[model samples]
Each structure stands twice: as C-alpha cells, then as structure tokens.
Target: MSPVPPSNGPPPIDAATSPATPTISHPKPNGEGEPADASLPDNYVTYQLSRQTPLPPITWGNWYKELNLLHFAVLGLTPLLGIIGAFTVSLRWETAVWSVIYYFMTAVGITAGYHRLWAHRSYNASKPLQYFLSILGAGAVQGSIRWWARGHRAHHRYTDTDLDPYSAHRGLLWSHIGWMVFKPRRNPGVADISDLSKNEIVRWQHRHYLQLVVLMGYIFPTVVAGLGWGDWKGGYVYAGLLRLFFVHQSTFCVNSLAHYLGDAPFDDKHTPRDHLITALCTVGEGYHNFHHQFPMDYRNAIKWYQYDPTKWTIWVTSKLGLSSHLKVFPDNEVRKGQLTMQLKNLREVQEKLSWPSDNSHLPVISWESYLQQAQSRPLICIAGFIHDVEDFLDQHPGGRHLLTKYIGRDATTAFFGGVYEHSNAAHNLLSMKRVGVLHGGAPHGLEDKAIPPSQRLRIARYNEMSGSGYSSGALSDGDGFMA
Candidate 1:
C-alpha cells in the first residue's frame, strides 16, 4: 500500500504551486497529443506524460535477495484471520449487507478510479469525483494513485514481459499476489508516469497514503458498523478484513485468472483473455482480452449487456455531470476486430487438419514488390502467402514494435512459438491481408524500364524465369528471398 519502485514519470506541475498556470487533464488522462484547452480551469488534470517510454522489460532481472518479511507476514496472517472468522465469528444480516456495500465501494475505487481513470486515462472526471475516488482508492489499500498507476502503466507498456509488475507469464500465484512477497530487487530508476509525479493532488495523496489507507480502509468501516448496527466486531470481520481479502483476491484475479483461462477474442498471441467468471469477480474486469487490446477505451465490455458495472458506473457519473469525455472504440474498428477474430478461428481449424488447400499456382509477385512496400505498403509473408499489412502495423495488439521486424519478411515463427500459438483469428487476419504469393526476384520490366529484349528466345526465357530479363543467379543478394 506504500509507494513502491519507479517507472519513467513526468515532471512536476501545479496550478497553485507552479510558477506558470498549469492545465488540468485527468480522465482523458496520460494520453499523448490531446490538445491542452486554454478554456479550462487552472490546476486542471491531464493524463499525458512528458516521458512515455519505460525501461525495457528485461532490465528488471529477478534480483530480489529474499522474500519480503512484512509482505510474507500479511499474506500469511490475513487468510488465517479470515478462516477463523468464518468458523468462529457471528455476523448480523445488517453486517453482511453493509460489508458488501463497503466491499463494492472500495473495489470501485481500485477498478474505476485507480485502474481505468488514473492508470489508463480512458475518461474524464471532475476534481470532486477525483477526490472521492482517490479517498476510496486509498481505503482499498492499493497504494496511492501515483504509485499504483506507475506500476500499472509499466504493466501496459511492457505487458507480459518481465518488466510487468504483475506479469501473468510468471505463473498464477506470482501474478496474483506472490510478486508482492517475492519483491523486486532492482528499480527502473525512472517512472513512465511523469504526468502523475507533477500532479499536486496526486502528490498530496501519495504523501498521506499510509495514514489514509488505515483511516479509510479500516477505521471508517468499523465506525460505520459500530454507529449504525452496534456490532463493531462484525463490522471489522465482514467489512474490514473479510472485505479487504475479497477485494484483494478479486483485483489479483484480473492479473491471474484472466490470463490463464477463457477465449481470447482479441489478440490471442499474448497472454490474457475475456472471461465471464473473472469479470463477475472483478465487477467487469473479466473482459481481459478486450481490456488489454484497447486500454484507452473506457469500456471493458464492448457489448450492451456484458456485465461491466465499472463501465456503467462511469457512464452514470458522466450523466450526473461527475465524469465526461468517455472514450469508446469506433464501431468500424470493433466490427473489423470481430471479422479478424472469426478469420483466425478458421485458421486454427485449417492448421489442425490438412484440407487440400489450393497451394496450386498462386499469383507470383516479386520480392522486390514486398521490398518496395515494406515500409509504405508493409507486407509480411506467412505460410507462402504475402500479406499487405501496411494498414495493420499500427493496429497490432503488441504495438507497432512487434511488427516492424517482420516487415517484408516471413513472420511464421513470430506468429507461433513452442509454448504459445496465435489465434485462428490472427491466421485469418493475415490471410486477408494477402496481396500475392512469394516470388524470388523482380519481374520482367520491373527490374529495368529501359532495355527492350533483343530476341524472342531471350524474352521468352526472361518471362519464363523471374521475368525482368535478369539472370537466374541475379538475386544472390539474398534479401530478395523470403525467410
């Protein structure tokens, strides 16, 4: 719950303390290129970061000396108390209901406030709502907004790699909560959330995180029980420890269960999937595949009735004038994604069986054509089909970085791995991008615009080979060949 290690963070700015009047932009937060509005109030919050990239995922090697004693103790004791309370403790009906209420509120603080709003900057919230969410988030004991969001942002930036704080690739327990106990021995030395480091309110919240967590998480719930129902013990057991335990597990499930099970309707190459069970547990975060693919979109559930209370909560807040500028993925893109997913599913079926596919005389296109399109047209070769993915470079779920290496080259291994495999959706999507089949070299006339063939035999041989009238060994440069 305390401030942890670093990601590359932003420089400080303030409306009151800063020398220049600062602009605010939280909610549509941490995004790049959102034009600063001159019409807004001073001390406005924005989520854009001055420094966006974090250290590579590989930098934070497993250097922890040993288990963190404090984390070890808490992990051990909290569950022990919960078991004892389950057997020995008596709870009034009032206690159970109120405890559920408290649990819901605190969970929202983490998912809605800390995760979506602050960490992802998927929407906009007013200062009052920000304050409300921050306080409740503190009660959830998930660290201050800056601290929580810093780690979360890194998780997005590096994803399933080692740099991710809750990397599900490490295993279920480790991704869930064991990382807290094992601890990181090293730091990134910079935070990827410079936008937060400079926010005055965020800074204030971080400064008082420990005290606020104790007050908001424990004392407040206990006081409500004592005053309302005259059962402080039940309040502490149900609303305090029991509620906290559930919230913690629910949050961790977004990291653990989400990656381990369910169908990946989005990019299946990466860990994580969309799971109804995980969503019900996390109050809407079970749409892990969608969440990972569209982090900036405010809605995890892209459907009308996908059980995303968090999305509904944000929508309601906007209706109540508490939140605004909620971002949603464009409809066309959604449809395109669905189509791509369906295609990938078909690909999986094809891979599992040999269906006499027409490998017969595909259109022979020049490798030179792919070379020319490598940047502008951006093509990738997979299973002998050349796909024009210039439009797909930026839209790739792993970001543009992952696709760059495969430009004008075969990406078969990149798409499949020993322990992992891309979805049938991916294969189908790749197939749709197909422009032509592999040809070793430039075609006739494509190599040279000038010289006409001297003889009919020469022209016939040229056309018979790669065409362009070049010699058979002319493409010895090797870059002309597909990998």
Candidate 2:
C-alpha cells in the first residue's frame, strides 16, 4: 500500500483540523477587562495552524488495485462459480443455510454493533453484549473496530471534503470500494481514535484482525461442514466464499448506495439519507440520514413503523437486560427542528411566487411576516413555556412551571438568555458550532472523563495476553456482561 500526499494548496480550516486552543485573556485590576495591548504571542496563530498536519499521501503498488479488482471479479463470479461447483459437486442444503445464516449474523454485527454502538456510541450495551457484537464485528474482515470507528468518525467530521477518507463526492467507484483497495494515503497521526483505542476489546480486535476474520469466516464454516454436511468442499464454496461475497457487498452498499439514494428527513448538509431497501440489505441500517443526523441515537428508526430489525433486536435485548443506556434523540426537538426547516422552505417558495394582486388572492404569508406575528402572540409564548415545563416536569417532579407560557412565539432569545445562558447553548453559540441533533449539545454533566494512560496500557497488555492464549480467562458469553 502507498500513501497519498496531501493536496498542494492552502489547507482548509474546517472540522478536519485539530481542535483550536483559545487565547486566554487575563482580567485587569479594578474589576475591568484586560488591556488591548495584551496581545497574543508572536507566531501563536501559525503555531496553532502548524499543529494541523496534513495527511500523508496514499501510495499503493499496481498489484493492490489489481488485487481489489480481482476480489470484485470474484464477488461477481461467485454465483457462476456456485453453479459450476454445484454441477461438479453436490451442494448440500445445510451448507446453503449455514452460509446465509452466518452472512446475516456477522453482517448485522458490523452494521449494528461496530458502526452504531462502537463508532457512534449510539447506545451503551452490557459487556457480554459488547463482547458478542465486537467479536462478530471483528469477523466481518473490515479492519478492527478501532480503525473502522476512527475512519468513520473522521468521515462524519469532514464529510465531502478531501479529508474524508471515502467521500462519495469523489465518485461512486472510489467512495464505494476504491479507497479500501488502493490505500493511497497513510493518514499517519491522523487516525484520531484516542477514545476507542483505549478500549481493550477494540485494541485486541485491531491487532488480531486477520486472525479473527479467518477464524470466523473460514474455520467456523469448515467446522460446521465437518460436523453437519461431512463435505468440506461444500462449506468452502457456500459458507466460505459465497457468504463472504454477499456480506462484503451488503456492507459496502451503506457506503456507496446509502449516501447516494434515500430521503433525508434530518440534516441535509451531507448525502447520508434513509432508504428502506438499503436497510433490508444492511440489517436495518438503511436510515443513513437519521443515523448521520443523530449518530448517538441507538435506534435508527425512531418511528415504530420503520423497518429496523437490528433496532428491534437491540430493544428486545435491552428489555431482557442485555443492553442499557439506549440513546435516543428527543422526539420533540427532532420534529420541531424539521418542521422549522420545512416551514422556512415553504415561506421561501411563497416569497418567490409573484402572483397577480387581483387574481383571487389566497392569504399567502411570508416567513418574516409569520415569524413577526408569531413572536407577537402572547398565547404562543405561553404555550411554548407550558410545553417546556411539562416536559421537564417528569424529571423534576416537584418543580413548578416557573415560565410555562411560551410555546409558539419567538421567546427563544429571552428564554435562552435567561435559562440556557450558562449552559452549553452559550458555548455553542459563541463557538459558532454547527447545529445537528447528533452533536450532543453540551457535556450534559454525564460525560465520562478520559481514562488514565496507565490503565489504558494495562488494558492493552491484558488484551494482547488474552488474544495470545496466555490468559486463562474464558471468552465472555452474552450473559453476565450482556445484562
């Protein structure tokens, strides 16, 4: 594999850049602000900018892309090969059933477990659930959980930009599968997965990625064939090769097709969208738009009617005490924001229409006019307050509606300034943060602090030892830890 060099232009100062360090301002004596002469140190800005190192160029040998092409060929030719193999050798029904079952099980492990749980932290699961999902995810042969989550997180952080590892904006062929094949860039020092890297399971999976893939993808099938079918060739053909082909394409579709098609009910800043067809193939992960909009949401299909078997699985497991901390976007906030955007679009259309004054005019309202009217309405203001108070009532139980009277009006400025001022809202506004349901507005006072480096090293060592079979700890099944 070869590394691709960074583009030879001024780097874009987008989300892809490292977090900015703020310049501190010291307070002056006499309770006044510091003087303007207290300037930033020389080269401070340049130093900060220099911290944002460009990703290394991706380079690959001719055989790398060629090998990928071969894999693609293999995938396409698998069905034909299956036919040929069937004629040459008896293809058992058990082999076919096993192949299909394992394909779906491991595929869901990647989409539902790795992508949603590990990468996005959509929800917290029990240790056994985590182990089960992580192991299955590791079997997908798509790199380790840490690597996948790192790349995926970066993709979301800098979507559509050159920094995006597999941006669909590049092209279908490139985004869908080419990036994985060529590996033209080694983003050394760019894999910002400090959080997940600290995880022992993730680190273990990353190191023994190939081993896990081979074991789950091939060994398991061989074992099944030996015991059930008594025909190793049948297992190799169906459960091994054909199953691999099916899982690969189905998972890849999320990258290529999921972004290209489907309805975007959430944010539209990027191509991630919801598609029922894609979800069916990807184990209820078709709601890409919602996923992107609320990456922390464990349930992709927030609505009960949406087809999400993976979500159902998680839900049932949670009820059975197999999962916990199931995250979800607040329905009111999601709906309200969507409605606001839609109303804005409608107002824009109304404004653009130049209807004749005398031609049976229906009362068409402009956005600005509507906003002004709504803001002036006392009833609207009262209603908004009432709604907020009611929602918070459950949490505070004994708390009364101190300002329960501002629902439909433009009391946002006052309400926000008064209540949410000292909260994350203030920081977000000051920092000019992008609005998205998935952003997790503030720290929420429930964030887990960074784990100590010493503990991390110990975990890594434990994982290494465990994977090497030196540790006697039995593999955690989905029982104690899952609950």
Candidate 3:
C-alpha cells in the first residue's frame, strides 16, 4: 500500500508516548531566525524535523485499544517461546554453527539487500544475487523487501519527527519495538517506492511473503539440521526462533541505540551517531552518523580500520560479478564534514578559555620611566616590553640569579642568545608578565651594542610578535622608583 500522507491521516493512536517523550518544539540554532552558533547543543542546527504539530501523548487508559493484534501476537508469542526453547532444547554443535553462519547471511540480506540495494540504491546486484538476498532476507522475517525499504526510506526522509515510522525521539522502547506492536492512528510521512514497484523480484517476495516466512524463516533451518545431522529440535529453537529474535533486536538497535548513544561526527544536526558497539551489533550499520549524512554511500564505516562486514561483502560481491555500481561519497567532501565537526568542538573549548589582553590596549612608558620603575620591583625589559618578573623569578628555570641580574636592564640580547636561548615556552610564560611597553619600543642602543648576530631579535607573526603581552594594573604606582 502507498503510504497515507501524515497531514491527511487522523490523529496518531499514540500507544507509547510517556513523560520522557516531551513535545519538544523543533530546535532552533540561535533561538529562532538567527544564524547558527556552533557552540550550541547538537540538536540546535539546520537539520531538524519540520513538524507542524507534536504527536499527542498516549492515552494510557485506552492503550490496549491501539495494540496491533497481529503484530502483538507475533512479537509477544515468538520471543516468549524462543526464551522457553532456549532452556528446553540442548543445542547441537552443528545447529549452533549453522545458526552463526545463517545469522551473517540473513544480516547481509538486510544491510546489503534491503538497505543498500533497494532502499538507498547505494549499489546494484545481479539477478541471482538479488534472488539470494531476497530469500535470505525473508528468513530474517523483517517484512517483504518492499515493505521494509519503504519504511526505511521514510525514516531517512523524516528522521526524529512524528512522521518517522520508528522515530528515535519517542523514547528507546517505542523506537525499538513498540512502533510495530502498537498501531499509530496517523500514518507516517510517505516515501516514494516507484523503484521498488518496478522490481519483479520484490513484487514476487511481497506476494508470497507469508509463505516465504514459514518456509525460509522456520522450516528451512529445522530441515537443514534434521536431515543433515538429526538436530531438528535444536535447529527450530536455536537457529529458527532464537536467531530471529537476535536479528530483530539487532536491527532495532539501529533505530534506538544508534540514535541515542555515541557522538555525531558527521552532522550533529540530526539524531544519528557513530558508535562501535552499535556497529558490532548491527553488522557494520553502527557508523550511523555517516550513513544518515551520505545515504547514497554504500559504506557506513568509511575508514579502512573501522569494522564493516556489510561493506566488505558488497565489495567482494562486485569482484565476483554479483554486485556492481557501488557508490562512494567523495573523499574530500567526507573530510570536509569531519573537519567541520572538529572545528565546532574546538570553538566550544575556545569559548571556555581565558586569553591575554590585546596589544593595542597596553600603556606606553618612556625609557626614563622604565629605568625608574626597575628599582622598586623585579622589572626586566625585553623585546620592548616591561615585565614585572618578581613572582616568576623563583619559578624561572634559569635560576633567580640570572633573572635578578637582568632587572632594571635591557636583556633582549641575552634572552635571544647572549645568555641562554629560551624555548617558545619561555616566551609564552614571559608574555603573561608584561606590565607596559617601552617608549619608542626597545632601547636599540643598549640591545645592539656588542650583541652577536645570532642574538639579534626577530619579529614573528600574530601572537609571537608581541609575545601576547598584558598588564597587571600595579604598574601605575611609581613612588618607590629610583629615577
């Protein structure tokens, strides 16, 4: 069925909304109609759900009225029996191994088939490969390819909104499984599935989806173990019901945990995040932030070291002529997204830090005044700046004597190389001690006489030029000077 438009549909039956799921108005970057501020929380950005109205909260008294009977039965009955089967059945090694192998096979059906091939069209698969994935995807029991892909596409188009089929903003439980178990009175926003309709294999799978579920999801696993090694009970319990349970929950994590946890490295404007645990659970779908940002890119984890078995499978299939036309977002563009987030984080840190006063604000003192002020305090003149080094004298790595000897004198040459060439660290530390600037800059006569070529001062750019000088306000008192 084509999705009913959200606006045209009746009010949502809302069966899971709770106090935790507040009616948060769509967040604004800088409190409505202002330019975005990078320092704001992740949600306060351009990419957000544009909803006319919040979905109404659930009426708990009538919660049972909204329960989807078929969905409630399958979801409730299977998991309970699967749990009981776990305790009753003794799992055979053969069935256990098949379950592990089949788990990966079915997972690829969702990731490579339902997700990449049909939903996002990130790649193309050969007819044989398509058939293989469709059958196995049915075994995963997550609805027909057309059904699953339509909802998934809608999820991308309307993420974190009421129209999203499994919107993460509704709370983890609702996103994970409650959306399926309960019926929404309002339809989710529509996604175009014209491409899905054109695919003969998808139509075939949807037509026979129920029969396929019984055959591929249940009977095949039981028969594989029974006929191969006489472990039908183990196969039905462990490989069939139990494996299905895990597959469903793992897929659900992409909707819940992927949105709830981890850092958004690509774009924090949406709910998706990149987390290792989510990747490990979802067979490489854990790089959700990247996936949401570049939906057409076949690979979720773009880095070589990141774990993405789904991407590897697609790549290997291309070599075997089973799949082709794999799409990749431009490397430079991807890097730009990463760099943007890094800069935003740096801006946040920069906001919290203290910086020295600007050079233009410093007081200009005469050369005569500099010599006069030196007698009262441990004042040293270097690189044109008057520094009160009284507090830093004992902390100086060169010892108190070296600093004491330079007091009331121009030590620019000695600081550069005549005594000891200091590190950039020393320059930075000295900058903080600045009290004032010498009139007409440094005393060139005192600094130039007998100073070796290596000891000559050099001007650098930006902060290095002035050594980030600022005053302590105590420099205004001059009564104790020797002038």
Top candidate (TM-score) = 3
Model 1 ranges with Cα > 4 A deviation: 1-65, 185-191, 352-483
lDDT of 1 by residue, 302-383 (tens): 8897889999999999999999999988777777877678767875664574221122323455666666766665677655
Question: Residue 399: error of model 1 in Å?
Answer: 59
Model 1: how far residue 462 lies from native, Å:
26
Question: Compared with the true structure, what per-residue lDDT tens digits does model 2 show for residues 340-372?
Answer: 556556656656644212101112222243344
Better of 2 and 3 by TM-score: 3
State TM-scores per candidate.
0.61, 0.58, 0.77
Candidate 2: RMSD to truth: 24.9
On residues 58-165, what C-alpha lDDT tens digit does candidate 3 reach at each position? Answer: 688867887889888877877798889989998888999999888888888899899988999999999999999999999998899988998998899779877798
The candidates, ranked best first by lDDT, are: 3, 1, 2
> How far out, in Å, is residue 390 in model 3?
2.1
CA lDDT of each candidate?
A: 0.71, 0.61, 0.80
Worst 10 residues of 2 by lDDT: 433-442
What residue runs in model 3 are displaced by over 4 Å at the alpha carbon? Answer: 1-55, 438-483
- In model 3, the Cα lDDT at residue 315 comes to 98
